[model samples]
Target: MFRLAHISDVHLGPLPAVTYRDLASKRVVGYVNWQRNRRRHMVDALTDTLVADLKASEPGHIAVTGDLVNLALDGEIELARLWLETLGPPHDVSLVPGNHDAYVPGAFGKACRSWSAWMSGDGEEGPVSRDTFPYLRVRENIALIGVSTARATAPFMASGFFREGQAARLEKILEETAGRGLCRVVMIHHPPVRGAVSQHKRLFGVGRFQKAMRRCGAELILHGHSHLPSLYHLDGAGGKIPVVGVAAAGQAPGGSHPAAQYNLLDIDGGKGDWRIRLTRRGLTGTALPLADLEAVELSGKAAAFVRN
Candidate 1:
């Protein structure tokens, strides 16, 4: 089985000393929000502990969905580069950006530059940049596709959008990859399912995404934005496509949200005969290091099963 670990919204922090210039744009609002709430919930110490446990498990590949930096500050993105190092080399880890990574226009560019290695496509020869999307990375019997819905928005908005270009390209990628008989897993930072999240944080073109997958279906999808462990399905070429979401990897206990958590997907089989399973692991209580939250066999085709 190809073992993969999934985590998101680590929101790594210990905000660097910021000058007024850094907060001139939309960051001013984000800065205020960080001081008020984000700082409390997103704890780097907790993130380190959780990642330590994850590394001990030695997952074959790691998928960190997004929000590695809380404010997308210049310093934060740089820090994220170092954080990416602690995880492993680019080839071992796959990542996608989140709204915070694109908190502002320039910050998004910075993040792209800093994390390009983690997003480069398979056999990519050119200098990797943000312009490339629907990047394909083939691992064993699975084809991991990365999509970017990350974009800067006005204050109080955490929405994501998938343009027609990405939608069309993604459809083509899915169609071509499936012909090769690989289990396709699409990764984005936002939930692409309708009604999966609240209005302000919703993906604007979820229908366009669903439409693409409907025409050229995939085996699974992974996303992070809601800060909750969520599992949903969408009808695909042969059966239902599983869309899974994970809560923040750095969030501490004592809040409306759960403690730092992540998912382990055990995938085996090939093409139409794939057998996939999931294990949810996270901090169970204040003193608990890491505990298995749930485990179950996912439907090879359509039906269902999951714990928490």
Candidate 2:
């Protein structure tokens, strides 16, 4: 079985500690709010639990969907490498960059440079050549494609895109790799399809992404940037292709609530079927399955029965 684990929004490092310079400006209130409420929510603690639980699960592959850093700091990128190392090597682990990863000028570029120097692992730098779609790590019967949507934008905008360049390259990859019986797994930090949650947060090129994926056909897509559990199906890929969004593996700048969860995707290689199980990595280093969460499958696609 081609088992995989998916985690996202692991905003590692200590809780945000900030001092406001303006007393009456809204920024000051934001700083106070962060200190009072958000700073107390250390979702990164879930990473510890997740690492332990993942080791126990022993997934064949892992895909992380970005937001690895909190403030786009250089130190934060280093912290992301450390956190990713705890998961495993780059050959087994795959990742994409989120909006937060590119918040500052040339932040993504600098982080990429540093990660290549330190924790780029076995990650290939490109499938698009210009550094937008860095398709890497094709092993066994799977093609893991990672795209970069990280970009610096206005303070109010937190959107991502692959635009024409990356999207076209991805289409070519999918087409060239088709009928090879290779399970295609696309990874991005932003959701490529619109749904109920798209009301407030969404990827800028979601429609285009959908069009491309429909044209080329993908087995599954992994995403983050929305710190909630979401699963949906799209129209283009013959059968329903699943897109999943994982919860934060690190603390969020909100409260001390249980906003820490991730997904374990088990794909039976022989059967060509996949199932996703959601779990919450608790403080005591336990992976507890979220109650009532169901494993979804496309019509006529059966999951390998694993009797526990």
Identify the runs in model 1 with alpha carbons over 4 angstroms from their true place.
301-308
Clashing residue pair totals per candidate (backbone < 3 A):
0, 7
Output the TM-score of candidate 1: 0.97
How well is each residue in 45-123 modelled by candidate 1, as lDDT tens digits?
8888888888888888998898888788888999999999998899989999999999988778888888999988988
For model 2, residues 79-122, the per-residue Cα lDDT tens digits are 77776777777667887788877766667786676554222324
Residue 26's C-alpha lDDT in candidate 1?
Answer: 84
Residue 55: error of model 2 in Å? 1.7
Candidate 2 Cα deviation (angstroms), residue 92: 1.4
Model 2 clashing residue pairs (backbone): 38-253, 38-254, 42-251, 43-250, 43-251, 44-250, 44-251
Q: Candidate 2 versus the native: TM-score? A: 0.80
TM-score of each: 0.97, 0.80
